[model samples]
Target: MSRKVIVTCALTGAGDTTSRSEHVPVSPAQIAADAIAAARAGASVVHIHVRDIATGQGSRDVALYREVVRQVKESDVDPVINLTAGMGGDLFIDPSNPTVHLPGTDLVSGLERLAHVEELRPEICTIDCGSLNFGEGSQLYISTPDMLREGAARIRELGVKPEMEIFDTGNLWFANVMVEEGLIAPPPLYQLCMGIPYGAPADPGLLKVMVNMLPQGAEWTSFGIGRNQLPWVEHSVRLGGHVRVGLEDNLYLSKGVKATNAQLTERAISIVESMGHTVATPDEAREILKLDKVASA
Candidate 1:
């Protein structure tokens, strides 16, 4: 049995989740408030993704990221702030032109994606390990080996812990390669993203297979989308891993009953405690993740 399980709340994802649930935080104020509440409710880490409030579309503007980080730090929230470096990797191809990227393709260099982590120095940030065919369309989430190497190196130099985001088995293998290449810090962190259509399925058998591939001495968490989110709270624990929950990956406590990010965290904490496991606080979580000591941000 796992002694201590850390809960990470993914506040607001960059997907089209804003309209799916009115409870999803849009403005920076709302996002910060939700994060603080989730921390108070027992989440030790908060993964964040900013949006254009007017249009609810994902954005990579540093100004928006700066405000979000500032608000979270200024507030009483002590959860580890994890900004998304996975933004700028979305590649919507143009079949018409074949060679040219479409309007939706938000292709940016690895350095450009880490601007927020470099400037704000969040305790943790995601370094998406590999690219894959996303959903049923022509959309592809491209994170090539070269980009992953550069992103991991930049994050390492900034003294930020990179939570290697692995969408599939291949991604996990490549993360190990980065570790060997001296691109990442020691004892690399991983987040096993399950059930995103084109990626690995949200099955216990598959999750175990992915978990088995984790490098020795790696810290990891696994999460499944939609209905699988709640089940993963227990699955990850039993598999010697941590847990993550929030509106970013799921919205309802029950169908037709929307849930706030704090509610989701509370529920996950309850499950952890029920299983004879204790949850870690932000400070404690930092130590477990081997993150830099909190600065006076």
Candidate 2:
């Protein structure tokens, strides 16, 4: 590969992986420290999802986001921040009584989900392209057309790049539709998420097709959760797209070996280098994605 590949570290996802992995960071200070460490390890971007400190569950708290971002910006390393706006869409329903919402249900409007993004205004914020049966339950992650349109319009107004997440072909199709409708700004960034239960499986053929499906000149990255994470780095780089890795997507650096954000990032950098390609810095990544620096807010 002749191009500089951008590596993103997705630290501590909203999932209940905390119970399984001791390495997952839940508090704001820990998340910020992890983000800084990942940046120092050569990651161009840090994709953050705050977790509730008390319960260790995913949170959309602006205060948490503020503290994390503040710490990162004040740190020595400057990595591109990509906050998750994919929260607040979780809807757990009872199969027997479809209308009954389960206890952990967190359904909210799309704009409401952007509370953190609006306040912190990071360089990038992810927008899930469509709704899907998120996992092995009646849980549905909702992102309707009208909701998405409204979010996109607001994100454009704020001048923060929306990192469109493509979990399936349908999501990709709608993202393209959004592009045509002018909801997204130019040189859109896309993150192809795979191996997430009910969404797209971690298949190379499908990944290639999805890459082809992306609009010309789009900056894209791909990742697979669990065991597929590290291998997916190679897969994504081989296809000329960027790569994402970290504890959020995968717990282990190798079999039964837990990994930290920095360890995962170092491995990804090694992969990019082994492939005879350079890994991008934050500024280089910003140039690749055509992003302007968002002031600390």
Candidate 3:
């Protein structure tokens, strides 16, 4: 049987892309509006990251999250909401003095990071499974084992599916461990993130290996950054995993063509259909992922 692919549009990311792309949604209203558009364009899920309205930088403020969630839920189209709990884990150390933290540092306890999630009660939320060097700096994205267990447990307690964001093989390892330890519920959802700085490189061989390492019966999705975005959509579907796309991963739809969340989602749907697989609806996605139906507003 041909598989049903779930297309998740990462509406806005906590990156510096707002300045680079005119379509990146910065405000809560824009993010929610774009999410609805993506859903109408055939995305079953919408991954969200709220930004500071004044600066267009990633923010973990609960108020911003509340507004975004509110607007998305109130909209006519109902896509599965996947709020990111990956913020508040960034640690940027001073290059000269390693002991001193830099301005970009925003470390917080695990529960604190999920403040919005606990309140909003979205059907799904992301939990970075491990730490990484992050990018071209003294910066690190920390998610220790203890932190992962705590966050996973909290998400489960709230009856929310935790989408484990695996940046590398080691992160996948820990995610499997979380599943084994009963922190992550059955049919764990993993997001095999690729082409992000020093983490897992966007190679077919690496993705194959990562997919093989996943717990049996796990639901997985994959994406690559920049130019690799669309290619990875076909790659993930061919590999029997779902796909993610949007301005968050790539600013351009084609070379020099800036894209919006809706456009990216439409492109993903086209790729899935071209491969003879139907794109899953939000209801079908809920059934596939074994998530509870979201209540209407």
Off by over 4 Å in 3: 293-297
Score candidate 1 by TM-score against the native: 0.96
TM-score of 3: 0.97
The local lDDT score (0 to 100) that residue 94 gets in candidate 3 is 89
- Between candidates 1 and 3, the one scoring higher on TM-score is 3
TM-score on alpha carbons, each prediction: 0.96, 0.97, 0.97
Error of 3 at 155 (Å): 0.8
- Residues 164-236 of candidate 1 have per-residue lDDT tens digits of 9998899999998898887777667899999987989998999999888877898999998988898899999
The predicted structure with the larger lDDT, 1 or 2, is 2
Residue 271 accuracy (lDDT) in model 3: 90
Candidate 2 or 1, higher TM-score: 2
Pull out the clashing pairs in model 1: none
